[model samples]
Target: MGLSSPTEIVATDKVEVAFKNLDAAILVGSMPRREGMERKDLLKANMAIFETQGTALEKYAKKAVKVLVVGNPANTNCLIAMKSAPSIPKENFSCLTRLDHNRARSQVAMRCNVPATHVKNVIIWGDHLSKQYPDVHHCKVNVSGGEVACFDAVKDEAWLKGDFITNKSWKIVEGLPIDDFSKAKMEATATELIDERDTAMEFLAKK
Candidate 1:
């Protein structure tokens, strides 16, 4: 079945007008970073926005609603949102770290001359900032016959940690326009929640 188009709801200060009966909510609104501005620089402004939204979510959203914070300083913003909404489980709130994870996978695949889908287990650790580490030490890439460590396939630590982390050419990626990057990040965040749900189901089944 074809998916129904999402209804758009614009609200000011209060999300109650829009958040009613929400199953999932993705918070992507925040002050955009200007050139030369660091993610940390956005912390205060974004936290204020998140705090207000979080209160609104607590007032209007379903208690089980999952929230993904995609704004700048995402990690801290997510924490602020979660704290503001004490009714929601902390696990239900997450920052959009999947974008960094996907970037790490794509970079590993490019360096190894393999498809991005072939790369697995690339971990994005720490804050979602410049200091974030995309470690491929445990990642595996599908080879001609078997899986091999991505780090072993691409024996350049500098490229993996430095260039790969900094060089996300936002112009063209596999013929897709850079304008879709925002959508891609949102999709990645959604995918993370789906995976989380699946894991929870698996654990429950094993109990």
Candidate 2:
């Protein structure tokens, strides 16, 4: 999943080739990619892997529509991927902040005791980590037959940037109660249709 492997490379090729006919392709990775190798070496390890895969996408998946990095060191990994895929438009390379945004929306909605839809749109900006600014600004919603605004709850740009900086760090899930939780969750989630009625839609599309 990190770098080039026979099966992964083959699958990547198949996807790229298939998508070329459809006019676009997407590449996703599970871990963050970073800029440098460090003393602890963990960050560098993922970066190396991402760099290699990015190169592969650049070379073989030239026609891809978008490259979305959801992995840790997301921004760095995105940068690495984009760097590798010179053929792909840089604007097509984006890191996923939807999950973080979802968290923000859900939290606010629950706080207001409403479904997430009522919160309208929640934007998670910055690095996509805790430091990420879950700017609820510009968000609107219908609640209790009236409009309730909470975006202003976050205040301003400084608060958002400060929030992002304050929370940027490695994320690790623990106490899963089982060793297989990671893979199991991923497999299960990946298999589920994101849009129940539209099976062709991305399993995690925001829409």
**Which candidate gets the maximum TM-score versus the true structure?**
1
Candidate that scores best on lDDT: 1
The C-alpha RMSD in Å for every predicted model, in order, reads 13.2, 16.4
Model 2 residue 132 CA deviation in Å: 1.9
Worst 10 residues of 1 by lDDT: 169-178
Which stretches of model 2 miss by more than 4 angstroms?
A: 1-26, 32-40, 151-207
Write the residue-wise lDDT of candidate 1 on 1-207 in tens digits. Answer: 111236644554436666666677788887877889753445556666878788878888889988888875566667777877899888888877677778778878878888999998665645554445565666889988589987678888667656775643011125522235334544554565444334433433443
What is the number of backbone collisions in each predicted candidate, taken in the order shown? 0, 6
lDDT of predicted model 2: 0.52
Model 2: colliding residue pairs: 25-65, 31-71, 32-71, 32-72, 131-164, 131-167
Clashing pairs for model 1 are none
